[model samples]
Target chain A: MLGAFFTGSAIVERQRLGLAARATLLLLCSGLSLVDSLHQANGSLDVLGRLSVLVAIAILAVVAGAAWPQSVWVPVAEAASVAVLVMANAGPHQPLLPYLLAPALEAGLIAGVRGAVATAGAAAAMFLAASPFEIRKGQSLTYSSTASEWVLLALATGLLAAWARRLGVRTAGSNEAYPAAYRLMTQLRTVSRHLSGGLDALSLAHIVLQQLRDRTGFDRAAVFVPGPEGELVVLAGEGNVPDWDTSLASDGLMAEVWSQQRGAARQSGFSGTKGLVSMALPLTIGARTVGVVALERRFKWEMEDDIDSLTSILDEAALRIETALLFSEIRTIATAEERRRLAREIHDGIAQELAFLGYVLDDLAARSEQEDMQGELRDLRAQVTRVVGDLRLSIFELRSEVQGQTGLGAALSDYVRSIGAASAMTVHLVLDETPNRLPVEAEAELLRIAQESVTNARKHSGAQNLWVTCRINPPAARLTIEDDGTGLGTGRDDSYGIQIMRERADRLGATLSISTRPEGGTKVDVALQARPVEIASDQGAGRDQ
Target chain B: MTTVILVDDHELIRQGLRRAFERDADFEVVGEAGTATEALRLIGELQPGVAIVDIRLPDANGLDLVKRLRAGSEKMGIVVLTMYSGDEHLFGALEAGASAFVSKDAPAEDIVAAARHAAVSPRAFTASDLAEAMKRRLEPTGPRLSPREREVLAMLAQGLGVAAIAKQLFISESTTKTHISKIYEKLGATNRAQALMSALRLGLIRQDPSPDRP
Candidate 1:
């Protein structure tokens, strides 16, 4: 359509040039004699006069199209526009013309709302200036109707242009914002990694603070607010603290800033903060205010934008920190639990033996007065001796495998020799195969299970002999402890032995079984296999029969 | 009279040991030394048939003196007398060439017999002797862990769990665990029961009350 219009423009301009090339044609074109005669004959250049001019131009352009189709459309638009201009000049209002609305509509299509409004305003000014001739001549023109029609045309054009421009702006703006959103999402993922990797609360807070500080170039940001019992301390900051406190305008309002979990702009327009605009963003982990980031700017800049960026960065970081803190707290709890367990073992095994030895020593001291009871005294000495041997084993267990750093077989062997020397019940440790230290969880659970089994024998089993056998092959470890003692209680009640054996086996992701030997004894067996290397051991172990 | 030599690093211990051997009518102290080198020189010159040694000597560790004495001549019956935890020194002394391992913590009569036994037997360690030998063999390693550390580790070994251990020991859970951890290190234990078992072997603790089951 534009091409067609351009072709017409070219053709009409050429014709005008051709006419100007001839003096007679140019004079006829520019001559004022016909226009003056028409004005004199009719004081108004009204409807008939404008229509006649258009018809004449139409005929002339058609007749000259022998020139070119490529240059015709612009002349057609220009001729229609010029005739309308002439008619408007001649008349105040052509109340009966539907086609008169087309020019304003075309103006709306051509240059949008601003241009159309300008054109309508210029046309209106021209009409009012020219209206004096009609008024003086007492033409009794429909001034209201004509004004209303022009106003309506201007309004319509303005509305159309406004709507189209808005749509275009929004579409372009959206395209630009999406990539940034994508970049922020990637940053979010990286932030998650950093937070989880921190492994504890302090590290998590530091990470969050760094990200917020770097992402938004706030002059100063600090997490001033403390959370629940003052346990939660904020660490991330963007700018210098002096600037923040003063706020470039000295309200001296950290409390005010913190209260408003949203961002605050305190420019240094006050006595305290004249150069700073401090922004406080609440670091919210869930609904709780774990921390608050206060950002202050000493310089006049785009402070709000930076605060917005800071808020987004803190959103994910808060969750991450909260999670990391929780994990660390849990680990602490677990360690405490583990220590208590070890203490119990020591109490059960060696402390009791030493106490017994004390009793034996007391008996021996008292018996020195009599030689008649020498045989009985000798038996007590043997018992004391056995107890001493058991105590040695207990000490070895007390030392344990120092973080599972030593090999299992060596540790077990050390265990047997030490404990066996002390106890009446001899511990014979035989290993069929040896493997590298089982990875942390596997080895730990394995060790725990063995400990439980041995303790059970020492206490309830009353076993005269204990054989701890381990086979490490096929990427698995099988532990079996056979005690020549009473069978698994003949009949059952709640005994801690089975529970412990099951718990240990489950912790290592292993299978476990307990059976009474046909030879009138009991055996506890455990088998551990490999599991996923990444995730840590299952926290809540299940007992599988 | 049977001549005797005494070697103990501690002054009081040496004095006590000297007093102990002197009490015996048949035994007479010919010489005394606080260290292995001095003890060796005295033995070389004096040639006392019975030599009393503290498991721990100033110049050397373990039972090298007993080994040194026996290797030099089979006539010397060397006895290791020391205050050792459980089997740490008991086994170590035997391995290093001591004829016997006797606790200084026990009645001095035991040490005397260890000396006399070394003098008469002059043979390999038997089952009854093996337990004492093993104790002395391991004695030099270290004393039985402290009673508290042992008690904690023993309860842990019973599979009482940390909460139960704490309750049983009347300690805070973490303290109980700390004791357990120390026991684990001393006993070379990985878990509670191992700690307990090791503790039992070390004489750091005693057995638990038996279940009321018949």
Candidate 2:
């Protein structure tokens, strides 16, 4: 009985059961067994026999009560030992059969109906053998009655075993389901937290994919979401699936799953190996298939059974993706509108005031006879132009959206020209690249990196000449920004800009290096590999607007 | 004197502009209007030689007013003065029949010169600023050529044929032709000279330093 409790405690820990109830059951079983074992001793022992019996019981009690049992076999072994001890020590006339019931009942509860019935059968056989020993010791046996009693005992044990088995199955099923549910709940919580925290769509998608990969424990997982072209493009993936084509055409199993807007098992030929079964789960929100998650290593039957679990997680992820996209849209619109308002205000207010100042200076210049006064007025007018240029650039940047249709190269070129016009430095821009736009997220990051580097140079470096070069070579590209400034490390106390650039480069899977030129100045070099191929016939046809 | 109607919302700007014009013997401030309706009425009543309109009037866009004024009379000069410096604004103004487009930050002399030029030859008047922006907006590349394409066009303008450009750019001749074709496509040109001319006019390619560039 005590061993049953020990085994139960182990199972409870593994299954995340309540600790307090299991501990109480263990204590109650141990106390009842000790009292019962002593009562059945029937004064058959002299002091030495009594001492031996007490010692034996004490040892059994300690093993059953204190020993930690991890497996079902541990408790089974203990039950067998208890039955043997009971048969060997209990006197023939005493109520000896009751002692045998403990082990049998425990086996029933811990292991199932078959285990219980088998244990009872063995106990009954041992008891019958003891009856023969009793007959040899001149104790007459009522054979007919004893045979009926044995039948009754076996019948009772079988019924108890069946009852225990039903209860055990239920507990086991719940034990399996609880943790999966909890993990999914936690994942949902994280998604909401990230959304409220205003993480951008790319970062949010990346984090969610990582979490899904970890939680599902798949050998390989990749998230393929529809790009602006309604073509499935690999957004993020784990394991040995990186080198595969990033875009998916509308005729494969992946596209079929997307069109079907449901999950099913399909076979894929990955990396030349044929017939590898994979589960393609579409992430749909309100009848629209937003994306598909392809998972290798999940068997067909297993996925069919676990589809509910997978869908619950994928559903939440889809909602999050939708929310993130909406959040970014709202942010973009709000920012653009706000900037336009500010620009209009500045144009009406400060710009007009400065223009009036310029005219005033012009009037003073025409009237003044002093050459020095006219020169000062001219210098002041130049200052006003610089201020106006600065304002215009600000307005342009605030209105600039990386996801805008004009493409990143144009935006960067405009920016560089504005800088040249505003500052004393001679800025040269060389952008030779394909017209195909980078993914919106990548464009945004590249723009940020360029802006940071240019601002850093303009503010601190005192550079006379700045050269910004962007070259696109189909699936790869390079951006090199060099300045004839006081070399790389001269006066850059702010490491934040460099850190941000590194982070952006890392996110884009691009290599970035900043170093001092051997001849003069500083150079920033960034090399980007891989541009997602367009699979859809028409670009940007997916957006309803 | 070229009689000019100054239609700006800011009183200080109108006063300063009036003074700048009063100083110039070739120009006169015939009227001033703060709103589009007022400007239309003043133009109709005073019949100024030129009307300078600010784009962001409280009541109406200067482009719409320009169109309305142009529909009324082809002879009256319409000059747009605004803070917007993008090619889009310049194009919008030009499409609405404004003869000149100038940034608000331009020197007083530039505005006076634009007014004088517009008053005399309203049909032929295209301020250098407006003409440059218009050319950029009309480029086949649509004012957004990548720097490398610009470099390629500049080299082509200097009379480097495809093979010479390829060698200079460290690329193959086939690649050079591809770049040249793309440049031509962007410039809306059927041949090399047309692409070069458009690129030069758009300020996309550097003008050849030769005396014959114009």
Candidate 3:
């Protein structure tokens, strides 16, 4: 019973018991058996004599099988030797019958149920075959009952080992699945991070254009959405079409595609254009067409397959594009709402109170009778008026924005003009803008950077003249604010305005450089490069054709 | 003396303005209203020569109220007084037919002058910065062109053919054509004459000195 407990624990405690530990366990069991036999024989060599040799051989065979645990033949050989030892002492007490179960358990652990059953069957057969011989040798008449008990013990140990093997297999399988699950979780985390970063609509539109070009191999393509007056205005485009119309008329092919909600292809001569085949496809979300993709290729070919594939890609991306568009609209609205709220708060609270204070000063100035006292009151009233003027400018700045129908150039012109009017410095503005505008988000950022630079110059730089120049081409722009003021002084490298300008530039992927010009002024220049969207090769190929 | 009715949501502002007007014998504050509705009623009953209105009212936009008062009586002087001094607000008040637009930050003397101007000529619009703003707006602001494109535009405006312009600029004919097309695209025109017209109109390129041009 003790040996059984030790062997069972060794199998359960360790997933794969080491060969040395198994040898130790088996030798310990053999020693206990030898001691038992010696005690039963009164220190005589009678029963212990045969049992000692068989126990020694049994331990050797079990250790050998443990050494070669992966080999099926080893377990079978171990089982045969143990079965022979069991039959040698099988008559009445059946001391070695329990030892036969060891090989069966080892075989079960090594090869699962099949090996266990085979070893158990061989042991049972040897026991039955040797039982009649033991009975003939006048051993005992109760040998049949002992033989049945030995076979039942062997079968039970085999099933237990088989059960342990199934548990081990399940654990191994789970161990293999852990990395796969971890990888999937990491991907989900990355995707969620991007989603939370606020996907803007322009980037989505660019992506749509990119995917369209990659799939259809169009020479030129443009994305058009309905303008305020219901005309199709280009939101984004790629490649070189010299006659690329920024806005399409209501009766144009692109507009027809948008209104009819179907894609159509036309030969070049149909539109009275040369060497270009045009295709217009509606970008629809559900039943509503949100925009149109206008494509032009150099040569005419069968477009059925191209149209089908383009439609599928657009269909797959429509929901994400719409969501991004809606999100941007909401963000714009929220920003405007917050700005309006701030403007209202300032106007209603501090502005009103300050105005009231100015009025009070006016009344005080008028009420004072003494000339000297009245003069002091008038100076105080002038100071109040100055503060009120500053407050009014602040309120105007809060309310100013690059809203609909007001491009960045107009907004900046208005702001700079106001600053000039309010300040003592002379402000010069030169606006050179392309008809094509930047993405709304980029324009907004550029406007903010311009505003910060101008405000910094106005507040800090004791300059007499401020020159603001804005030059814009589609996908590229440059804004320079140069002031004939004191250059950036010492210990002002990390000013808050510069930090905000840098951050805004970083967000727009633009470059901002602030330096003191040799002509005795500080100059701030911000430049934005065209996006790297794989258009040069396509344009080159088209022109070559 | 010119009678004045104050239409402001803040009582302190009205009180101060009343005191300022009391010092001057030419103006008399007949009534004050804190809301647009009350202001309209008071203006109807009092018939003051000038109605000083704040752009932001609790009940209605001060510009809309100015429009209503203008519609009712064409000769009634309406002076818009508010904290907002943006060009949009100035223009909004101007389009709404306010006679004078003054920011709240202006001294009481300026407000009195604007009211006097409104009373004298109610049809004329006046603001302190109106002339400066108009000058800034009238300055040429249009689509930017490259130096090369400007040269090409000048040549095109001078009635030079594409080949002649190409030879003069020392660039390939194809390059010159590309530049011309880019100029056309930028100007939103189709032909050389249209492009030149757009350029001349936008001050991109000046009209040449021709004897018969004038």
Among all candidates shown, the one with the greatest lDDT: 3
- The residue pairs in collision within model 3 are A433-B144
The TM-score between candidate 2 and the true structure equals: 0.56
Q: lDDT of all predictions, in order shown? A: 0.54, 0.65, 0.73
Evaluating just chain A, the predictions reach TM-scores of 0.33, 0.49, 0.54
Off by over 4 Å in 3: A1-197, A201-315, A369-380, A489-499, A532-545, B67-78, B88-99, B116-126, B137-214
Clashes of each: 136, 4, 1
Q: What is the Cα-based lDDT of residue A206 in candidate 2?
A: 59
lDDT, candidate 2, at A204? 54
lDDT of 3 at A455: 75
Give TM per candidate. 0.35, 0.56, 0.58
User: Residue by residue across A1-545, what tens digits does model 1's lDDT show?
Assistant: 22344445544553453333222322433344345455565643444465455445444544544344333233334324432443355454333222223333333433456545654555455555555564435454566455557556655754574466456445545564577568755765565466432244445555665565445444344454343222222233322231123121123444454455565556652113344444566667545665565544444534357666667788887666655555544554575467657655554445444534544444454447776576666666666655554553444454565242455655565566655654567777767532123433344456667876786677677889998987753236789989998868843442665776676565445789888888877788887643222111111111110
User: Fnat of candidate 3, please?
Assistant: 0.42
**Backbone clash tally (model 2):** 4
Order of candidate numbers by TM-score, starting with the best:
3, 2, 1
